[model samples]
Target: MANTSVQTEPGTRRPGVLQAVLLLAGSCMPVLGSVLLTPILPQLSAEFGGAPGGEILVPMVVAIPALMIALFAPFAGQIVDRLGRKKLLIIAMFAYTLVGIAPAFLDTLPAILATRVGVGITEAAIMTVCTTLIVDYWHEPERRAKYLGLQTIVTTLAATAFIAIGGAAGAAGWRTPFWIYLAAAIIAVPMIFLLWEPNKADPTDSHARAPKVPIPWRRIAMPLIVGLFGGFTFYVLVIEASYLLVDAGVAPTDTPTIGGIAALASLATAAGGFTFTRIAKVGVNRILPVAFALQAVGMLIIWFVGGVPGVAVGAIVGGAGSGLLLPSMLTWAVGSTRFEERGRVTGLWTAAFFFGQFLTPIIMGAITAAVGSLPVAVGVVGIACAVAAILLGFGLRKSNMAPAEEVTATV
Candidate 1:
C-alpha cells in the first residue's frame, strides 16, 4: 500500500535553533570525513607502492563512496522513512568515525581501500538521511531555500578548510588527518541527546506503518540534468586543476596552493547562494540559465587561459554559477513534490548528482592516461559541461513547471 504515514506539511515543525544547529553539524561531519584525506592520496600511493596507472586510485578514495552512495541511496531513503533521520545519522556518524581512522593503522593498499569503502557506506547513509531531516525541519519554501544555501556554504567551507589542512598535515605525516576524524566522530555524542524524533509517527497507530514511496523520477528530471552538468563542471575542475597548475610550471608540492586558490570558486558559490533568497523573486527558471552560462564561461576561461589569473577568474565565475544552481535546483525539485515523498525525491536527486561526481574522476583519469596531459583532458570535460548546460536550458523551458510556493516559518 502507498505510504500515508508521512507528514504532508510543506515545512518542518518548529525545532528550536539549537536542535537545528546540531542537525546541520551532524550533516557537515560526513562531508568533512569524505574529503579530508584527498591531499594525502599521493603519500598513500608512495607508501603502499600503488601501480603506475594509479592516479585513479587517489580519486577512487573519494569517488568510491560517491559511487556506493549513488547505488544505495534509493534504499537508504526507505530506511530513513521506516526508521527516523536521527537514528540513521547517528549510525552513519559512528561508521564515519571508525572507517575514517582505520586507514591510519593499515600498511597495505588493499586494507586502506577497504576502509575507504566503509567510509563510502557511512557517507551514503549520512547524506541521504540528513537531507531528509532538513526537509522535515524546514517546510517554508523561502526559509528552506535559504537553509539549503547555508548548507551548501557550510559544506563548501568544510571541504575547502579540510583539504587545505589535510595538505599541510600530510607534509608533517600522512596519518595526521585521520586523527581529526576522532573529533568529528565525538560530535555524534552530544547530537544523540539534542536531537528529537518527530512525534508524527505514533507507535500505537498501525496505519502509520505504510509502504515506502516509490522514487520520483518524473519530477526530478530537470534537477537531474542540472545536477549532472553542475557536478561534471565542479569535479572536472577539482580533479584536474592541480595538474593544470603543475603544467604551467608549479611544483607538485605547490599543487595544494593552487588548489586553495581554485577553491575560491566555492566561496563565490557561497556568496551566490546567500544572495539567491533576495533574487529568487526574479524567477528560478530565468536564473538557472544564467547560472549554467556562468559555469560554461568559467570553463571556457580555464580552457583558454594559461596562467594563475585565468584559473582564478574561472573559479570565481564557475563557483558563483554553482552556488546559484544547487539551491535553486533543490528548491525547484522539493517544490514539485508532496512532503511525504520528499525523502525519496531528494534521495534520487542526490544519487544522480553524485553519480556524475563519481564518474568524473574515472573518466578524466582514463582520458589523462590516454592523452598524457591532465589539463587537456579537463578542457574536454569542460566543453562537455558547456554542451550539457545548453541542453538543460532548453529542457527546463520546455517542461513549463510552476515555481514552488515560498515557505516563511522560522526555526
Candidate 2:
C-alpha cells in the first residue's frame, strides 16, 4: 500500500546508504529534544525556582516540545504536501540548531521557556519530514519495514544516550546541556547535498495533471488509534522506571544503580527493535498484540514480584515490547496513503503518537494518585494492555490493518 508513484529519481541516483543514514539520524533530533533535557529538570527548577510559575514552567521545557509536536505537526504536514519536503526539512533542522542552542545563553526563565517553544515548533516540522521521506525513498515493503523499524531502534537507543549526555552535561551548569542542540546543525550539512525531494512530479506527466485527493482519514483512523496506545506504552519505562526502582527499595540518592537499570531496560527496547523485521512479515495485526502483550507481561512481573530483581526483570520485558510497538504503529498508519498525501498521513500519525506520549505522565500521575500506590496503578495499565492485546489479535481481521488496501481516489 506504500506509494508506488513513478518518481523521476534525483539525476541517476537512487536512495542508498547515505540517504537511509541521514534520514534515520534526522529522526533522532526529536528524541534528543524529548529526553535530553529530562535529567536536568531538577537543576533547572532550582535555578528558576524563584520565578513565578517556575515549578510548572521548568518541567515544560522537556514536555512542551512534544506538546508542540502534537499540536502543530499536522500543519507541518500541510506545508510539506504543499511546498517541498527536503527544503522544509533543511530549513527546520537549521532553525532547530539556532533556536535549540539559544536557551543556553538566555538569562531569564520565561525567555528560556520561550526558546523551548521554538524548539518544539521546529521539531514538529523536522520529525514529520524525516519520517515522510523514509517512506518516499523506500518503496519496497521489506525495505520500508526495515528502515521504519530501524527508526525506532536508533531513536530508542539515542534516548538512553541523550539522558546520559544531559546528566553529564548538567554537572557543569543547567544551561550547559543546551549546547547539545548544536548537533542538529551538524546533521543538516549532508542533508543539503545527499537528500532529494522524493515526490516531485514532472511538469508534463499525465498523472501529474490529475488533481489530487484528500488524506484517507477513514482508513487511517484505526491505525492512528492503535498508534496512540502504542505510544503510551512505549514510554512507560522511560518515564516510570526510576519510580519503579524507588518503589522496589532503590534509594533516591543511588543515581548509579538507578541509571544502570534504566540503561539495561533501554537495551531491552533496542533488542525488540532489532528483532522487529524478522517478525514484521507476520503483519501488523499479529505484531500489535504481541508487542502490547510483552509490555503487559513485564509490567505484571513488576506488580506481583517486589524488589530490585522484579523491577529489573519487568523493565526488560516491558522495554522489549515498546521497541516493537512504534514501527508497527507507523507501518500501520502510513500504508494506505499515496505520494501526494504521504506527508499528511505521516504527520497525523506523528501527532497521534506524540500526543499519546504527552498524555502518558499526566494520565499516569492521575492514576497513581487515584490508586494511592504506584504498583497498583501500573498493574491497572498492565491489565488494560492484556485486554487490548487479546482484542486486537483476535477481534480485528487482517484487512482492518490493511497496508495492501491503498487508496486510489483522485480528484
**Cα lDDT computed for each candidate against the true fold:** 0.67, 0.78
Model 1 Cα shift for residue 46 (angstroms): 4.3
Candidate 1 residue lDDT tens string, 1-411: 112123335423355566556666766765676566655655554565456546567667666777777777767776776666778888888888898888778776667778877877777787777777666665556566667666766776666777677767767777777877776568788778766554355332222345546657776776776666566666666555555666677665553675476557656776777666657756577667777777777777876885777777876787777777776776776654554576677777777777777888878778778878665665666666667667767766776654535422123
Residue lDDT tens for model 2, 91-185: 99999999899988899988887888899889999999998888777655667777888888898798778777776676677788789989999
Once all C-alphas are superposed, what RMSD does model 2 give against the true structure?
Answer: 4.9
Q: Estimate each model's TM-score.
A: 0.86, 0.87
- lDDT for 259 (candidate 2): 58
Please give the distance, in angstroms, between residue 230's alpha carbon in candidate 2 and its true position after superposition. Answer: 2.0
| Window of ten residues with lowest summed lDDT in model 2 | 402-411
Best TM-score among the predictions, by candidate number? 2
